[model samples]
Target: MSVRRLADDQVQPAKFAFNRDFAAQAKVWVSKYPKGREQSAVIPLLMLAQEQDGWVTKTAIEHVADMLRMPYIRALEVATFYTQFQLKPIGTRAHIQVCGTTPCMLRGSEALMDVCRSKIHAEPQHLNEAGTLSWEEVECQGACVNAPMVMIFKDAYEDLTPERLAYIIDRFEAGRPQDIEPGPQIDRVFSAPAGGLTSLKEEPKPAAKTKAAAGAAAKSPAPTQAGKPKREGESETLGTSRPVTPTDQKDEANAQSKTGKAAASRSAGAKAPAAVSDPARPAARKPAAAETVASVAGPATPATAGLSDRSRPAGIDRPAAPDDLKLISGVGPKLEGTLNSLGIYTFKQVAGWKKAERDWVDGYLNFKGRIDRDDWVRQAKALAKGGPEEYFKVFGKKPR
Candidate 1:
């Protein structure tokens, strides 16, 4: 980088002030910062001065300093440090900044610079005869992906051939720069391949389901027996065998009593006393069917019992106007739809969930602990109390 200094004293203007329109814009920029830190507006104010006068004059720098109540040297340091601020007069129509970094150079940026030298002036930063065009070779302008580019004022013209750049220069010189669009000047879309996609050309197909998975999905939940109200524990059985109920237990007890009475009658008629087991040994009892099934199944998962869990939050019908659940930070349109499908449609409903209910919801969504992490209940509470205004007041930002 070359040392950047102000233009000669002879060329410097005697005084400087923002025009009426620029003064209003400067005020707006300053207002964005806190009162005591209005100095943060220095960069924008200097840029506005350049947009109005075509360059950052020394007077403009001091004027901006005074407006922001910052030291003149602090403002000068900003102007001189950023290359975006031009210290000398440039082309009245357009000042072209050609990228000369490695990527641009490897892609023929030298040829583009040669075109600029011949068309505008022999040296960089020197104005053409008509004072309507100038060119400067600058470092990367953050468009390396679209290399061999030129930035005229704020717009970038990328993917440039020497001839294309020449034509662009002519257009700007004729005061019709807007005729040419910015970005790549080729048969390409933004930084994409020049012709078309080279990989992943075929659309991906969804994975085919295996026979077992297909059969499992096709099978619906077993229907409850007719003439019986579904028991509380029965609904949580998933696709396994029906759970042992209180009615089943009572019937088993009655059958055992009848067998005992029959055994007593047989013993009364027996010729000899029935054989007794030795005191030191005990007979092994057979495991009940329920016990066997329980051992095989291990334990019920959340998905199996989610619908019948006591801790699950109570859901209500959709109101005349449902609260926009998307207002919560973590709930997008898709998540809002999922919540609606569960009959959750109001902020008050969400806010009322206890920790157990929250865990149920978290498990239902497979969200681990995201519900607690995002503080959805608190967010919902704020919205429930007074809508967005209250939410923003509590959180210090607008609801997502």
Candidate 2:
């Protein structure tokens, strides 16, 4: 609800001549709707002005108001209702908007916000002193599959923790393309079944059509032939209904006849049992299995679902890549798996990872790999200490 309105001068007004073409475009946009429904075009018109000028100016709002035949206040209403419209000014290069919605909050959004707060040197909606970075806390931008996310310009950074998030923001600030990372930045696998299992099977569908139905629809043309009578010896008493074949449809005329109940019966007779476990077992919850094995903890610390309780908050660290995995010499992939299993998923998590915690995971995973070799705990210590260089100082060199 609280937004920092950038000073008017922060964003310059668009050149004067630009309005001529912008009005043309708005007219074109307005024409798309039914003759009298000009109001429906308010969103797109405002969007075009924002796109052209970087931020919406009062003059542009007036322009839209005039074009749509509505009062200026009405145009302003449409613009302000959506965060997409910037009223005052914003950083031209990077405008990072973090999601503080339920899902992102539930999965460490605040720690991510902490990274934003430190790196941008301002809280949400406040531009950093350098005028290159600004962030705002907004509602869901639809990346819940990879929650704890932020929107940088038009692209999304998902599955974030404070560590991975900090590096990502720094990379953008340094003029690096933030497109390097793939999948969600966190443990989620694009909305996997619990524990993220995958399955491919057919179930009875009451109303929904299937690939088979679609193919049938495409192939067959006329259900009733103009001249041919029902085939002799084909008694309706058979109780086997044939899918309607389009007699007019040359290609599908025979497709339906060939793939009847006989074919279905044959497939049903040979179908194999699926390998997925039954519901009532330990594997009952798929994502839960992977969640176990670490932190032997309890109910989440008392706070709202998206809110974390922080007397003193610790953040996670990121190694930048799998090659950095060796930094924690003892935390080879196997130990890493145990750590992840124990809910200790990232290096920053490992860095914030307490010594007692490391001992616990080391003991639990029976770590033959000596994680102490890389000093990941200390490395994480420095990450919580400050920015990028301080982060790399612990490892003795910066990541390229």
Highest-TM-score candidate: 1
- For the record, the alpha-carbon RMSD of candidate 2 to the native fold, in angstroms, is 24.7
Find the 10 residues in a row with the least total lDDT in model 2. 304-313
Could you tell me which 10 consecutive residues in candidate 1 have the lowest summed lDDT?
A: 232-241
| 1-400 per-residue lDDT for model 1 (tens digits) | 4677888889899999998767766777777789788888888889989988999999999999999888889999999888899998999999999999999999999999899989999898888999999888888899888888989998889999999999998898888988999989998888899887899999999998899998896784555544344556553323224787787667767878999999999889767777888889988799999999999999876453267789878889889999999999999989999999888999999999999999988988989899999999999999999998678557644697
Q: What is the C-alpha lDDT of each candidate?
A: 0.87, 0.64
TM-score of each model, paired residue for residue: 0.54, 0.46
Which parts of model 1 are misplaced by more than 4 Å? 201-205, 212-400
lDDT measured at residue 164 in model 1 versus the true structure, 0 to 100: 97
Per-residue lDDT of 46 in model 1? 93
lDDT of 2 by residue, 1-400 (tens): 5653433754555432346655566666677789778888888877777777777787777777777788887887777778888776667668878898898899888887788888885556667887778888888888786787888766777777788877777777778864546447655556664355456546756897889999997876433343333453332323223543444344454556776866888888777778897678766445565467434665565332121323222433433442243344344556565454444545456666556555554444455335465566776556546534555444433332
Write down the lDDT that model 1 would get: 0.87
Q: Cα-based RMSD of the predictions, in order? A: 18.5, 24.7
Model 2 TM-score, 2 decimals: 0.46
